[model samples]
Target chain A: MKGADRSKLAARLAHDVGKYVARAARNMPPRGATPAMVAMLATDLYSLAGGRRASAVLAELAGPFGEGDERLATARSLLEEADRLEDRLRAAEPAAVERGRAIALEVQSLVLDFARMVASR
Target chain B: MRRLLVIEDGSEYSDFARLYLADEFEVTTARSASEALRMLAAESADAFLFDLRFDRAEPGTLVGDVDATARRLFGGDRGRALRYLQDQQGALILAELRSAGHAQPAVFVHDFPERRLANLRQLYGSVAAVASFDARAIGALLSR
Candidate 1:
């Protein structure tokens, strides 16, 4: 992809992921909707962390921004936490749901922080 | 220093301006189109820095009419129309500014295609865009 296209994709992904994570943190779904919500969130997290588009965009961004290793490490950490939360939520444990919410909030913060860093570059 | 008004639904652009462009420009911010117009009516800015997507903005503060947009373009799907408005809010805001007789140079941090950028310049005079939030690039665009 061209440089402009790459930057556009990276910024769009960052904004989208930040919004999704923030929403998840703000509104925990009701009991009946929890499964669907968790599934959707998990899909987003997985895509953000490991999907081809995301990886490519992040790699391109990492080079120009010179935060390649740190950005990749952060994505890996988020992916692991997302996996653990998905497993725990499968059991329908109340504590697991709370933990998931907390994680979402943390992820949201991190995403915003990353965005700010990118913006200030 | 030249005065630059950063307009967006959030603090990102203004924060970037303050942190990165303070030495070259005096920065002011408005989070909605109405607020920006009001500011412009009271005082002039040498340039504008716009954020294209206003996803975090409240529905009411957005520049376009959602219902009308849905009816005209989205087959009456309000959800899609709202998203469209949010995504294009910056340009809509520019349209408003132009209509209101504010012809200051406007810059966006977006990778707009050549044709689209040309269209914007045609529709709204003195429009420019950069691909990302590089302070140097944005500074150069705004300075011009």
Candidate 2:
């Protein structure tokens, strides 16, 4: 990929991940996101930014939400975990990546089921 | 008298709920989740009515010029504010109740985004019963 394309890809990834983080932190019901989901999201983000700029992107998205909010607190914690996991996966072999994918799918299933229930009601 | 807890951040809505339900049920009001939990600990209420959005937003937030991207994602100021509350304090009182092992009392949410009701239920593990701010819904819930 050319320099410009790479930058654009990084930007898009950051923007999309930031939105999901915001949704999970701010809009997702409490207890809705499991630790695995957080980890997976972080992994995706870490890969997209090659672990260096992921943290900055997350901070930009979640930093403005203010300090006392619980959602913000959760997002911050998740970001830290993602950062750590990103480092660990890089140092070791990429094992948790597959597990994280399964967890993400499970989370998606739960969300879909909930959405269906809501639609029926 | 059957006891009722009204968890609303708005004073006018709290007062209206108290007056409206006072004749049939002993209505107690709390302006925040913390207050509501304290009240619950002090006395066992037969039912609860919760306002979806509480007054928990940080000051100086909703006033600034929002970026076009944010506005597109979350809509206007009110929508953004409501989303914040729902994410932070939404269904908190109910979560507390469930955590306390109290049998789910006759509970209803007032003025919540209907679209997100299922989301709340997903977090709390039960369908959210809807309630209006009016006396009629209050009476009906308590009557059942």
Candidate 3:
């Protein structure tokens, strides 16, 4: 992909991922979704987007969650997965950007599912 | 480790917070303003997190007679009473702390909307860093 196309894709992916994350984060219980987790995800996304100083602040603001809580773990995992995909999208690696877009869709879907589960409970 | 004092009504919520924050902060929990005051008197905390409503209802000084009517209208549920208390006492407690020569701690108010949080910011915003309940906001305080 051309540089402009790549940058546009990266921005779209970030926007999509961030929207899902915020949606899930708002609905999940405090245990499942925390400010720290949100902050960490923001930091991860920022770092991927080359905002090193901003990422540093976010990293510090992130808090810990219970390791044994399944909901919290699931949220954390999704965030980490999104971060990885963001890395690929940011790098504009040969085949990875397309993969990142695919994963972004998948992650958003999973996050919506997660939000529904919490809502039901 | 940084000392963190968390004032929340529910044990489960406090426990959850402890689990999340224990790695970086030495966490202590209190359920009410009175308990928190006692704790503060004993030792200082590096930062503070307060749930806007505690489980128990304590009489508030600010909105005086209106509290009783509201409590009666709501069937005297402690949740409503406690919210009244939060608005009344949360500010008072912070003011008390400031007057006592304690260095104002980073304060995060949870379980509250931006409007209520803003009330706090209006009162103690200059004396301390008042923020809404976000881990990143808390983290920003910690970073400072």
Pick the TM-score winner: 1
lDDT of 2 by residue, B18-135 (tens): 5455677777787655666677788887776655444443323222223542466565565564444444453655676667765444445332346766676666654345422335
> In model 1, which residue pairs have backbone atoms overlapping below 3 Å?
none
Winner on DockQ between 1 and 2 is 1
Given candidate 1, what's the lDDT at residue B57?
A: 91
Over 4 Å off in model 3, which ranges?
A: A1-121, B55-83, B86-89, B111-119, B126-133
Ranking under TM-score, best-scoring first? 1, 3, 2
What is the DockQ (computed on Cα atoms) for candidate 3? 0.04
Better of 1 and 2 by TM-score: 1
User: Model 2, B21: alpha-carbon shift in Å?
Assistant: 1.4
Tell me the lDDT of model 2 at A25. 23
Q: Quote the TM-score that chain A achieves in each candidate.
A: 0.57, 0.39, 0.37
Worst 10 residues of 3 chain B by lDDT: B126-135
Query: By lDDT, is 1 or 2 better?
Result: 1
| Model 2 lDDT per residue over A3-68, tens place | 444343333333334322222222112343444434434444353333444445545543443455
Chain B alone: TM-score in each candidate?
Answer: 0.97, 0.63, 0.61
Docking quality (DockQ) for each candidate: 0.04, 0.01, 0.04
| Clashing pairs for predicted structure model 3, backbone only | A35-B135, A36-A63, A61-B139, A64-B20
